[model samples]
Structures are given as structure tokens and as C-alpha cells.
Target chain A: MTPAPGDPAPAPGLIPRDSLLPNLEFPFRDLNSRVTPTECFYVRNHFPTPALTAGGWSLTVGGAVLHPLRLGLEELRSLPSRTVTATMECAGNGRTFLSPRPRGVPWELGAVGTARWTGVPLSAVLERAGLPEVVAAWEVVLEGADRGVMTEPVPSPGEISYARSVPLAKALDDVLLAHEMNGEALTPDHGFPVRAVVPGWYGMASVKWLTAVRVVPGPFLGYFQTVDYAYWEEKDGLPPQLRPIGPLQLKAAIARPAPREVVPCGVTYEVTGAAWSGEADVARVEVSVDGGCTWADAEFLDPPMPHVWRRWRFRWQTPEGPGSRTLLARATDTRGRTQPTCHDPARGSYMITHPLPIEVDVRESSP
Target chain B: MTPAPGDPAPAPGLIPRDSLLPNLEFPFRDLNSRVTPTECFYVRNHFPTPALTAGGWSLTVGGAVLHPLRLGLEELRSLPSRTVTATMECAGNGRTFLSPRPRGVPWELGAVGTARWTGVPLSAVLERAGLPEVVAAWEVVLEGADRGVMTEPVPSPGEISYARSVPLAKALDDVLLAHEMNGEALTPDHGFPVRAVVPGWYGMASVKWLTAVRVVPGPFLGYFQTVDYAYWEEKDGLPPQLRPIGPLQLKAAIARPAPREVVPCGVTYEVTGAAWSGEADVARVEVSVDGGCTWADAEFLDPPMPHVWRRWRFRWQTPEGPGSRTLLARATDTRGRTQPTCHDPARGSYMITHPLPIEVDVRESSP
Candidate 1:
């Protein structure tokens, strides 16, 4: 498996050796799968997987600070923490759908997951790290423990700690020093024992196996978040930047017909799937049996959970009319966002919802 | 852990000896956090962990007609599978929220999780198993390869295979013979190789390390699903029929701030956690700082996958006021079904949405 055309380019030498772009599997196609199993879960490396130890991990906060300090994991953990329900999306999510195909891993739609992140707020940690002088744009430079003396140049530089900054305001959004995911300790690949879990943002912001976060006077520019994953593009021949492709956009899918679906009609069927958004609660999901002309709301099971996908269902009794028919499902979130038609399923790798189609056979209905 | 009133009672002699309940760093507050880490994941056992050689593992699904089957792992993998997002609630999710603490493990709260399930559809497997005569009610019993034999007399008499069945309907409702979770292979404990994943239901419906599924006639009256986890609760003060709590109810919680909360004023703090339901999608989660008077819709992070819990947040600028403020969160589904303010968290030890309380300081805002 190689990088899907739409996927983000590999961070400076981040692609592993002998690693053919692994063909990713779409999560939630089966009802008994791990929502985001370790392996298949998307990997968005800033530089490369840094080798580090928990016993020696320490984060430093500097700049215009009253007192700059390096707090050990033990010390960091000793501070108060805020748990958050956040969904981390890779900036390159759904990238494999890019037109002409982007040069990246062909992610088969399995690059996202929602988790209960537990960690000290970035503000508290930064405050504890001491906010150096009052600058226009505060840049928090994160440095990892991995052996990286100077892989790139300065100003527009690259370091080990995979550092990036928030808009001061967004940076203070109670980010967590996430020590856990779901309810288990962070697995090694996902930044064992620790990672930054920022809510409502892209995965790049949530650095893994993090260490030092130094405050600078200007915007932090690194190769990972800025150069590779982030992009500007236009829709339908419009001007660029109208729909910036930096972070996660709203999306949904039919989990029932996942991977592949086949059925004999005239039988009762419950069409179901999931829907989500960056800032929207899924309001409804519509399914169409005859293309996109007619739509119906699927019965949603249980109340919606924040940071989790909303499951919806629609019961259909196929008529014993004729041959095969395509069933299409589209979801809409509370922000009045509906799944877009598959304008071009292969065009944009991420964001736009690709109409999920299920092919079924028509049979005689039971009396 | 002993089976309390609300907890699902495993078979007699099923409780483990070294079953000292492990202490969690955080208190039981949210529906998702109730999930135990690998070490703490609740194990509802009917028999002890089995002993078998992978060398001899074989599954046979053939009876009356056409394509009778006996397939090994390799043979099964040759077939395609569908994936789905579903929540597996312990039939006794709210058992721990019972009155005077029920007679079980005294589970702190309803423990549940949502994951992406992958496997061949049960309908396909049944298609291979060949459709036997359709009975009135129907029973599609599934059993594991583990050791254990029920001594109870067969109530139905015509027991075709050691299996249970639902209305030939449920079997067609996207049941899966899942081999993967999220995107990785299933863990041995959860159910390796293969298992049945029934969406919109409790954990028991999913038979692990599945051995066989015989479509018998009539309803399933297995000890674990029916006699043990199911209950008769006084709904509106009436003890209805001793029916199994089929679907889940609205539930929400604050991951932290349990027992009590003590914090300095003006320090921007975050109140977050998970919420879920078995019956409908949670529409809105309202948090109250002044007990139950003032309600504010907290920020919720919707999951990219469906039927999972959404992580939610409510950021408040600590007021210049001072007093003991209790923090409580509740949920409502698309059907306008909001979690009740009921103090008792358990509904028949199965579904509980009891309001959780927390005390916080309202010191002046940080300078």
C-alpha cells in the first residue's frame, strides 16, 4: 500500500523503511470491530516516530516567562488535569479521494476516532511552564527526545519534538496531557503513556510521546502541520482557500454496507450508518433507494454521544418489482450539513461525503 | 466481583478467585470511563477460559439443504465482510447504580463502549448454513468453544442444535461473524478468530470465540441472557414482566469531579465526559452549574463513527462569586428524550441515567 494521491506527504523521512503504503481498512464496517484499532488507526507523523523513555520525559516551557521550567512526567501528572471528549482528525483525512490522486497513503477511510482524553490543560501546563513575555503571536516550540540535532534549517526549521502552536485562544481550549485513550493506557505506537489530545481540531496538534513545549515570540512554522498536511483548494472551479483543507471537515458513512454489501430484496432491512462533524451534532441521516431524488430518515439508536458517531437506521421492505437497485445514504448534522453527492468520489480524498451505495436484488415480498 | 442486583450474574462458580476489584485513578463518573482497562474490563463468564489447540479449530454450519459448511480461519478469511459501529452494553449497565447497592460486583456505573466491528454477516453464514424450517418465534442460539454444559432441561423439546434464534428477522439485521475490531484482528479475550456481533444489543448477544450458531425454533431462554442479566423493575412504580432490558436508556456523566470538587477561582477549568443510549441518539447534553436550575449545552465532539459516545465539553470562566456549585450533566435524544434528573442512576441495574453531582469553587477570575 502506498500513499493515496490525496493523502498528506510524509513528514521529513517519516515513512518507515520497507513500508509500502499499507492499505487502510475503513473502521466500523462490521458491528463487532474495534472503533479505532491500534494498527489501522491513522498515523500522522510530524518528523518521525521518536524514541523516548517515560522515566526521563520532561516538558520545558520558556519565552517571556516569570520562571522557565522542565517538569517531569511525574511532576506533570501531579498537576490537576481536565478530561475531554474530543475527536482528533488527521489534516489529510479522506485525502485518498483527491483528483489525479494525491501522493500519499491511500487511506480507505479509516483515519479518525473519538476518545476520552485525560491530561493537564495546555493552558495550565503552559502557565505552569510560565508564559514568557507578551508577544503578538505566541509560538510554543515542542521538542521531542528523539535524536535530532538539526535535520532542517532555522526560522522555517524542524526539530525533534514535533512542535506546533495554537492561536493563543485555541491553545487555551483546555487541551489535555492525555495519558489515556478510551479507558486504557496509551499504546506505544499512539505515543505510549502520553500524547496531547486537543479537541475539535486536526490530529497534528495532538503531538504524541511529547516532551518540551517552549514559547517563542512568533508563529511556529514546522514541516509537518504547515508544509505537508495543510493545503488550499477551490470547489467547482471557484477561487482557492474558500474551503481550506487544513483540518477535519464534516463527514458520514453507511457502516452496514461497509467494505461490501449484498442482499435479496423484498425482505425487511434496516439501513444504518454513522455521521459526524467538527462542530456539528448529527441531526439526521437520509437514505435513498432510487438515487438521490427521494430521501428518508433512518431510525437512530440511543441518544447521541459527544465526540462519537451517531448511529441511524431506516427500515425498508423491498418491493418485488424488478432487477437491482442502488441504495444511497447521506447524513446531516445539526449545523444543517448534509452529505454531499459523490460529485467525484475520487476527486477530494477527504471531507465531502461519498454517497454510500448498496446493491440489492428484488424478490417477492411476504404476504 | 460478586453479582450485585444490577450487575449481570455470571453462571454459578463463574466468578474468579483473584477478582479483587481494581482501584481506578478516577472515580466512576461517565458511561465510557466505566470501561475497564485491559486489566479491569468486566468479564461476564458462563464458564472458565477455555483450553484448545488452534491446530484443531474447526467450525461447521450445515444442516438441511445446499451449501453446508466447515471452514477454518484461512477458509473463512476468503469471504468478504461488512463492518459497523455499535455499542456493546452489559445487560446490566446500570446495575451498579442500584438501590442500597445491589447484590453484584457493585459496578460503579453503567459500563459500555462503542467500536468498529468487522466480520462476515450472519445472514451470509446462515445462507451457508442453509435455511432450516422457519418456526413461529424462532431461536438462533450461539455458543462458544469453551467448556460448559447446561444441566437445565430443554424447555422447547425440539432442540435442533445447541443454539438460540431470534425472529429469522434479527439474523438478517446485519449480525456479523466478526474477526476484527476497529481495523485490527480481535483480541483473544474479547473474541479472537471469530465471534458474533449483534448491533443495538448487550454484550451477551455477541458470543466470543464462537463455536456454533444453531437456528432453533422459538425464543432463546439461555441462563446468561434471560435469567441472569434481565430484570423486572418497577417502572413508574410497577414491576413489569421479568423481561430482559432489551435496549439501553439515556445516560451521561462527568468523568472527573466525583464525590467532591475543590478548585481555585478564575482558573479556567473544563467539565467533560461521555454519554450514550441503547434506545436513541443523544440529542443534547445539558450541564448545570447551579444544581438543576441553569442549563447550558456543553460543547460535544461527535465521533467519526456512529453508535459511539461523543465527548462533550463545557468551558466556563470562573465567576467572581463564591459558593458550593454542583456540576451535573444530562442528555436528550433526537426524539426529544433527555436524560432525567433522577438521582438514582440505575434502571433495574440495566439502564441508569441518574444525575451525578460535583462541588466546585467559584473564586474570582484569574488576573
Candidate 2:
């Protein structure tokens, strides 16, 4: 669907921009959004879109399995389960926000989305596979039911298993085998049926459309798991350091109905967006109508939860008289982690978690 | 094909050690290389691969034109063209080599590749389209036959097309709308039939599976062109710089076998590799046999051409005695640019070009 007039399409339609193209297109915006809408969710697809059907689907447990068995959706549902609301942001969400110019995907703002996931603990599936009763690192491979699966392992060291391993600890967290989202069955677009919910890790580790689970020793070095998300750093003659899966970093985004929306003369408005972190719960989310010179506490929609997003909203009365106005949103996660004031927009590695400043086209009120 | 047992796989195979998975998969080399075979080339699909039949495919030129024209493969073949054996590095090629950890598409070393891209001069196509008569500053957009086409009025102020644009001047260079590769019809994997060969620019500017050309005003920010390959630095302490067509920075790769090759004792060997630069030609490529202590000028293949790779070969006289040896290759491009020593694995903004120190496994030959 085409967006009317000069409006950027919300999630489900927003495609991160690529920098290398010859011409510039689109009127892009970086919404320091409070709540990332579904349609506006940023997407990062590795291969061709796999057309999966739920009717004949089953989650299979393989690899070091004593009894490799395929459990139908019904069977998976029969297993003990739980539910949790969490947010998942692509590591490259705010990539374009980086400086020194990070490589790979050129994300303008950040691509983040929150949803309620329902699934069984990854440990449950692995247990059914039977323990190897051995000592060593076995990577938990998650294979998607797609044609690309054939050539998948060919690309990575492990035969293309759509898998990522969690240490024996994280996999057993009463983490749900999410099948329902926000009280609705998982939509095909959002990995229907089941997907892993390994809280505190980057979204990539929470494999969408989770299928099989295995207990691999050592590290989960699936191409996407180990190879892709890893980062190697060499600053000033120091040895390079590689960052594997760790808790999410603190970040905030401001999103609203208005793109410089002109509020009626003297009309009041609300400043809102989302704040989250894999590190810790958010303590407070703040908004600055005066470009961060002053901060106002934005009410959190709900008490913060671990690895879950905290929605913050602040209501403000537009100045009785106005020419134009601009506002910003910033949040402070629980661990004394405040939302960044400005996205670094680094070019070399793609991490640009900048606070957003937006222009508001305010109209003067007539008496 | 699987590599021989004793021989290491091009990339992520086990490193014949007690450990199964190596600490790091893609080892850093001064020259960027994909460890996998051609089949394992990291597929950076900006858009779905365009499916064009070689039987009878034509390119359509429209949008701001005297008359919409369709040129068949034959017509494009009939046009005068040129070909160059250049290396196309994704502007984001070295993301795996970054620090402070940026975000976005997690691309490995494979994002860079060397191919004999063939194409007709885009300027010739514009002539056939009758430019000057059509539009000015009027950018041209290239749309692929693939369903994924950028929305109209490219997101950029330039209003370029879904494909990147070539300034009117550069488009007219001896650019090729190549029909053959290494003297063979284009392979589908290599954009068979037709594609642009934008010299000195990042791979994104050279749209694959060329189909539609729409000339308009402004930069063409298509999904492939703009949304995915850009870098922005809007941070507090930063200087403004003109964005160029993302060009491949100076890069070099070891062409000779890695240092790990087992060499019979007391045997002299040759150290070799290739170097390239996008902005300028390579001036000098040096080889350091003694681990960067002493340097020697490696022989550079002659008539160094822009957009073409220059091969450098250095003959090394192995010590007559017996012991494991270390071999190294360092290349400098034409612009007096020298390869940086491997100080840190994650080097620059996606351009991790550095001097390589190859390790050789030596076995003494007994009398």
C-alpha cells in the first residue's frame, strides 16, 4: 500500500535505506519512537522469503538426539508453556545513525519492535532430544523449513542448521515457546507457531520460527549466530576484541502520529515512543520539548520488566502562541543507562543508537 | 567441493586443533577474502535476484524521454562497450572488522568479489535515450526486472531512480553494458544479459540484472541504491563531507597460498598477492618476508589500469637451515597509499586493507 501524500509508511513497510546507491530516494525520518508499530517494524531477511505453512508443520529435535522425533504443532502446544512481552531490535536498527560510517545495512533510525511471545522453554525441546551426557560444546542449531536450508549449511561451518545455542542456563529460563503474540496466534509475518525467546540477547539469537533444538557443546557458532553478530575491535595497537551474544544495550526512540504535525493553535499534544534494554529494566523515560534542555518524566505504560520494553508518554499543552516547535525523547534504563542523547552514527561497525530530535510544525492559534 | 583433508577449507572449516570451532571464523587477512567456495559467496541481495532469460531479454529506457524505447540484448550488444577486470567491494564489506561495534547486516569477508563485469556504456544508453533532450541534473533510475522496485521520486532530494545514478559525465565514460565474461556469455549468478559497470564506485552503484532506466532529477535512492549502503555522521563533533558514490577503498589480498602451506625444508618460495584501489591506482605494493621488519618491492603486473587489479609477486629465498618460517605480503595502491600493518583485526569503516603476514609450516629436508 502506498502512503498518502508525504507520509513515511509505518512498520511492515519501512525498508532500511542502503547508502551505496547512486541516487537518494524517499523523505526519510528517524522517529525516536516510544512504541514501534508492527507495520513499521524494521526487517532483516537473510535469504529468499520462505513460504511456510502451519497446517503440516512440526518442530523437530535432531543432531545428538537418541530419538530424533518431530513434534507437530499440537504436540508442541501440549508441552508446558508460558508467555512474555518483549522487544526485539535488529543490531543494525539505528545503523545509519552511526558515524565513521558503519558497514553493511544502512538503517536510518533504529529498527525495533516489541511483541508478546508465547512458547515453551528451549530446554524442554532439548530434554526431549535426550541429553548427550557428555562434556563439550554442542551448538544448538535452528533450521527453518525453507529451500535455502539445503545450501544453508554449505555457507557456514555447520551444515546449514537454522540454529543458535544458548548456554545450558539461558535455554532453561521459563522462557516461553512463543506461539501467541499479544493474545493473538503468531502472524505468519512474525514467525507463527513457535520461535525462541532467549531474553537479553540480540534479536538474531531468538531465532524466528524456531523449529529444532539441540545441545551443542562449546559455542553456538551458526553463521548468523557466531559469525555475523560477532564484532572484532582493535583500538590503538590493542589486540582485537570480539563481542559475542550479550545483553541488549540501552536505547530509546520517539514515534508519534505527526511528522512535524501542525497542532491546532493552543492545542495540547503528547510526546511518546519506546525505551528498552537487554541489560536491565528501565527506571524512567523522559521527554524534552525544549531540545533536551529540560526533561519531563513520561509515564511508563507499565512497570518495567526484564528484557521488556517500557512505553513512556508525556502530555503537553502547546504554547498558546506558536510559530514552530521541536521535541525529543530520551529514556534511562534501570542500570543507570540513559538513552543516548545523539546516535553516534559510526560507519565502521553500524551501531548508531542516537536519541531522536523531531521538528513539529506548530500553527499559531487565532483568538 | 569439500577441500582436501590436510588442506584447510577456504573459510570456516575446523582448524585441525583440539577445538572444534575456531575462536574466530574468518581470520583477518590484509587482503579480504571469502573462505567459502563460489557457492558460498555471501549473498547480499538488495532485491530479489532478477530472473532474466537469455533467450530474448531487452532493457527498457523510459521516464522523462522523447519516446519510451526498448533495446534488446542484441541492441545492447550492438552498442560499443568496454570491460575491466576489477574487484567490486561492498561499501560494507569489512563490517566484520569494526570496533565500538556498529550494527546492521552482519556481512562477513565474502561481501567483496572480483569479477569480469561486462556492460555497455551507460552514456551510450543515454545517447540512445537522447539525453540533453530528455532531462538535466535529471537523474536516471535503474529498475530491475525483479518485483522489488523503489517507490517513485527517489527518497533523496536528487530524485534518482531505484538504481543508483551516474553523473551525466561518468555515465558516458567507456563504461560497458557487457555481454560476456572472460569471453563467455554472462552467467546468471553474475548478472547475465546486462548490468552496469560503474567504474571506481561501490558494487551497489552497479545494479545487477539491469532492466529499467528512468531519468529524473536528483539522487536516486532505491532500496539497493540508497536505503542499504549509506553512512551518515550527524553526531555532535563531526565535519560535513560530500558523499561520493560508495567506492571500494584501497584493498589487498594474499593470492599466494596462506603461510600455513607445508613447505619442504631449504626450499625457496615466492610470496605473492594482489592490491587494488578505488579512488586511485596502486603506486606500490611491498612484501615483508621477515614479518614486516625488512620490506621489498613486489613485482606489480604492468599497465596498471583503473578498475583493474594489479598482481604483485615477490620471490622469497627460504633460509637454507631448517625451521618453521613466516611469510608476509604487503601491497600499496597507486595513490601512494600503503597497506597498514595488521595492528587490529577490525580496522576502518568497512575497508580493512592491511599488510598480511603469512605463516608457513616448514619441514626440513634431510640429506
Candidate 3:
């Protein structure tokens, strides 16, 4: 049987998914608190999470380092910690909107969220381990404790530790080795013992339950890096550029005045939502009550915080006409990147940053 | 930071728990179908579930068999399969109600549910494997693929596989090696590759992610079998009787008219609930609205089915005077086993089969 368009009935706190596998997304409309609750944070596990006890688990840093280091939970905690409020978004955040609908988790707009991550910076750990100065091209590979095999991009399948690598510059940047999320120890779904938190990159780069960090001389060849998360740039007669997805694209989504919700025709209603970008700060957000035909700037509820999303709201007086109205939102980051009116099918499911149009029905006030 | 007592906000379809270590319970009040939905079927994982791929996974049946068999998923599926609708209740179902508060998952009344399981019966598998008919003290030891060192029951600190066993007679009697639950392939939370479904026994006896089945001479002594699930009958100054806990107890619980829920005085309310027993069928159920001072026979909505629960209801007419009231329910099985009013303190967390008292307030109705 074909899976329903989306998860028919998702667990609470999550938006439904196309795949029944545990690709859970947080319902961002319920984002009421400053820090997203651990239970409400989006969970994107490639495999079932392995349980690790504090006493028996340790993080090992080796390969291309002057000093190979193995640090237990307490030992890692003893290092100076820094906290950063970062917003993480999946590369396939709006995959359901992709035409020909990709054969993976078809997520909607709820796959993006923000949380206060507390941990030692990867740079700090690398400094203690003593990184060797090298002129050759190098990539820092990260291996999560979760081990499983993938059946996708088939024909050349093999078992792999859930592993990925980043360029040496990103690895030495503000990337964090996070052990705590939202002021609490990470839950099993979020990687309990420790996880890598790449501040501005898409979530898959933030490997959870991180156990190993190895510096390899050359570009990484992991399936997640070379195939799955890569985008195809199909063009006219030229070879498709298989570009691995990195930073998130500018995006905005309506969280309030939900789809198909009934509203009083003559009453003024407040439409609220969130806007975010990967590396750049959100400069402005626009709301369109006429399905992108016309747009109006939304008032920001909070000032822009560097790696975090900002909430924006717009008040609209309902039209006298009693019918359905389409609401749309688009965001522009400081880099002048704005959402597209529609998605590019050739790009497949990665970075689907098209503006979402929500429909709300207007009804006569009972009073 | 200390974890809160019960999830401040539980996911849809799951009942709250004292410990947040994924001790999910079914919301029995919403029990609406013939078989419990997989999402609502109550998850009880002592350790994190490990992901297993179908390609590299096999169930090995060795020891005391003329032919030691290692069957892959397809090979296992090729055999004759049977479907059984069985009710599974955790051994520590009502642990929260224990006087001295047990040291594990503090579950309340929601830790029991029924699901339709499909798989090959252990009897048929044993028969096909050519079990030797010999007169010896033999036990069938089952081990799950999940490996984790446990710290419990004191003193014995060593690495042991998650394993348990049963007497040869019980092992070969209608035991099912299930690969599916509720007509669908088991979810990872419920054991993905395969699991054992032992009817008439507690949920722990139905080990999940089963990997090995060894028929060994003499009783099998594993940590889960000899220590964790065992009861301690501590008598004053005397050695304790370390008896293994098994089978479901005669239990009844009020599903509707939840504790602390307000109801209009003088209104007729329908009180609904479910009751079940292992081995013996439920014979009768009694409900009391005045704290057990008086009792009334609850009307059975469905007739008692073997190994499945029966739904029951009662018409409760609220008194004209507005005040708080307590509701209670009890059950008796065909074996003449009745639920105790209180638990055995020395038993320590397993099988607390006492009638639950729910408190509710009465208020005036709105016109």
C-alpha cells in the first residue's frame, strides 16, 4: 500500500510525515516559550538511537591530531562551556512541496526550530587535542554512536556508522560539541551523551550522539555527504551539478491563523509566524493576504538574534466577503536572499524555500 | 536539573509516566477499537532500542536441537504463521501505588493494552527443529539483540545480554515468535526485526528484538530472569523468597470519569472502563461510586474473550447535593482470583493488583 501523502496521524507535538519512519517534526505553531522544549524539538534520526550510560561512554578525538584524546562525560564537562541559541532546520524542510514528491520523509514547514545549546566549542576541544598545521586538504569527520545501513540511492549499499564530515574551516569555527539542550541534558532522541551543533548549517551536519571526531586528508566520501543530502542541478545538456546541501535557505511560514481555521469576517485578527536563515540574520518578513499578489511588511516581535529565528506578526481586518482567503509569507535574510514563489523541481527535495500559502475560511460572527 | 514527575505535556496517544525514560502507557479512556493502535499501545523499554537491518539480521535457534537453525527474515517468514490478539500487561503495572514507592518506572493504571500479533508459534518452530523428547530439567532461554550492562538488584556487576527463560513445557505451549504487531510490521519502539509474544504472561516475558533461542538443560539463570523481574518476600529476620514474577493479575481500571474531572451534579453520567486477566478469563467486574462502601455490577459492553480485555460501563446518577466523590473498580477471573484492595508491600513493584480509587468533584450545571 502506498503511504498516505503525510503521516495520517502524527504523535502530539509533531507534524505528520510522508514516511512512517520516525521522522518527527515539531509543531512550530505551538512555539510559545523562548526556548523550544526538549519534547517539542524536532527529531530527525537516520536510525534508532542507541542508549549510552554516562559511566561507559566517551568521546575520542584522533587522526591528524598531535595528541589523540579520549574524554569521558565528566572530563568533557570539566572544560569551559559556552551557550548559543541556534536555530536548526532540515535540508528537506519543505520536501512535501517538491514536485514529483521525493521518495523520503515528506516534511512540511514544522521541521525548523530553535533551542539554547550549551557545550564546549569544537575549537576548544581541538585546541586541547593539539591540531597539527597541515597544508593538504583536510575534512573533519564526525561519527555518531548510532550505526545502521541505508537502502536508498541503491545498488551500492553497505553498512555505515551514522557519519558525516565538514570542511576544516567550519570544524574550527563556532561549531559546538553540545551535551545539553534547552538547559537540560540532551534526551535520547536529541543525542543524550553528546552531539555536534553546527550553528548555521542544516541539521544533518549536527551529528547526534557523537563518539568520534577524526581529521582525514581529503574530501569525505560518506553516503550522506556524497549522495543523499546532495542536490541535483539539472540543466540543458550539461552534467547535473551534484552539490552537497550546506547552509539553510531563507524561509518563512505562517504559524497562526492556521490552515482552514474559521475567522469572524468583520473582526481584526493577528497573523503570526517565524522567519529564519542559515548564516545570515533575518532582515525582514512580508505577509500576503492576496496569495502573493500584494505584500505587507510584518512587525518583528523581537530583534534579530544571530543564529536564531525571529517571530513576526501582522494584523489584518477581515474582508466583508464570507469566503476562504489565502495567507502567504516570505522572508529576506541580511544577505538579500528571499524565498521563491514556487519550488525548483530539478533541485529535488533539498532547500525547498518556497513561500507557503495557508487558507483560512471567513464566517459571520455569532454574537 | 531534576526531571519532573509525569511529563508536563505528553504526546498524543500516550499516558503520562513518573520517569521520562520512554515509559509510554496507553490512554485506556480512548480505547476505541478491537486492537490497540501501535502508537497508543504503551512502550516499556528498559534500555534504548537498537536499530537492526533485515539483511544482516537472523534468529539463531541452537542447543538441544538435532538441527541448529539460523533463519533470516525471509526464511522465517516462509514458515507457517498464526495471528493472535493478546492483552499484554507489564509486571510492574501499578508500581506507582506501592507504599514505599519502587525504584523503577512509576507507572500508574495505563500500562496494559491488547494487540493482534502475527508470527510463527514457538511450538511449531521447536517441532520443526526436531526437539529431543528427553526427561530432563530443561528451559528455553530467549535472548534479545539489545545488549546493555545493567546496574540493578545489587552486587552482581557484569556484562550480560538481555535474556530470560521459561520452563520447557511453557516454552513449547502456544508461545509465539512474533514479527508483526497490530497487523503491521513492528515499529522500532516495539522491536523492529522480530520479538516474542508469550500469551498469558507479563509483557517482559514477551521479549522484543529476539535474536537467540537456546534450549538448555536445567533452569536458565540470567540477570533479567533471576534478579530484575523477581519478587522478594521479606519476612522479619528470615531469608527472603526470591520468586520470579509472571503472568497478568486480575485487574480492573476506570477509563472514563478521570480523576479530578468535574461533573455536573444531578446529571446521569456513563462510567466506562476495561478489565482483563491472564490465562483465566474475566468472570465479573464490580464498580463502586462511594469509595467502596457500596458496589454495583458493571454492565459488560463486550463479552469476555480469552487473552483479551472486556469493556464495561455503568450509569452513574449524580446526587443533587454538590460534593466530591470517589469511584473504584474491581475484577474477578474465572480462576476465582479477585483483585486485592491493597498491594503486598514486600512484593516490590511487580503485580500491584489493587482496585484504583478515582476522585472527582461535583458542580452545578449551566443552563
Docking quality tier of model 2: incorrect
Question: In candidate 3, what are the lDDT values of residues B204-229, reduced to their tens digit?
Answer: 88888898887876545454644467
Please list the residue runs of candidate 2 whose C-alpha ends up more than 4 Å from where it truly belongs after superposition.
A1-43, A63-68, A99-110, A132-139, A146-163, A233-238, A257-260, A263-267, A317-326, A340-351, A365-367, B1-367
Higher-TM-score candidate among 1 and 2?
2
What is the C-alpha lDDT profile of model 2 across A1-367, one tens digit per residue? Answer: 1122223444334553543221111122434333345455555555434456677777767666577778888888888877776777767665543555544565544456766667776778767877667543345555554323222211222224344556665665544567876667766556666777667666667766766665544444334432345443323221122234455777666655244665655655655566778877878877777767887888876667778777666776677666676677776765676755554311123334556566676666444
Alpha-carbon TM-score of each model against the true structure: 0.41, 0.44, 0.48
TM-score of chain B of each: 0.74, 0.69, 0.91
Pick the winner on DockQ between candidates 2 and 3: 2
DockQ scores for all predicted structures = 0.00, 0.01, 0.01
Tell me the lDDT of model 3 at B256. Answer: 73
Cα deviation of A331 in candidate 2 (Å)?
A: 2.1
- Scored by TM-score, the top model is 3
Q: How far in Å is the alpha carbon of A252 misplaced in model 3? A: 1.2
Can you tell me the CAPRI class of model 1?
incorrect
Per-residue lDDT of candidate 1, residues B193-276 (tens digit): 787887766776777777766564433444343323454332221112224445566667665444344544654566666777
Please write out the lDDT profile of model 2 over residues B46-121, one tens digit for every residue: 4445568876688888766567699888777877766667666666554544554544344434355556655577
Measured over all alpha carbons after superposition, the RMSD of each candidate to the real structure, in angstroms, is 28.4, 25.2, 22.3
Cα deviation of B103, candidate 1, in Å: 75
lDDT of 3 at B96: 68
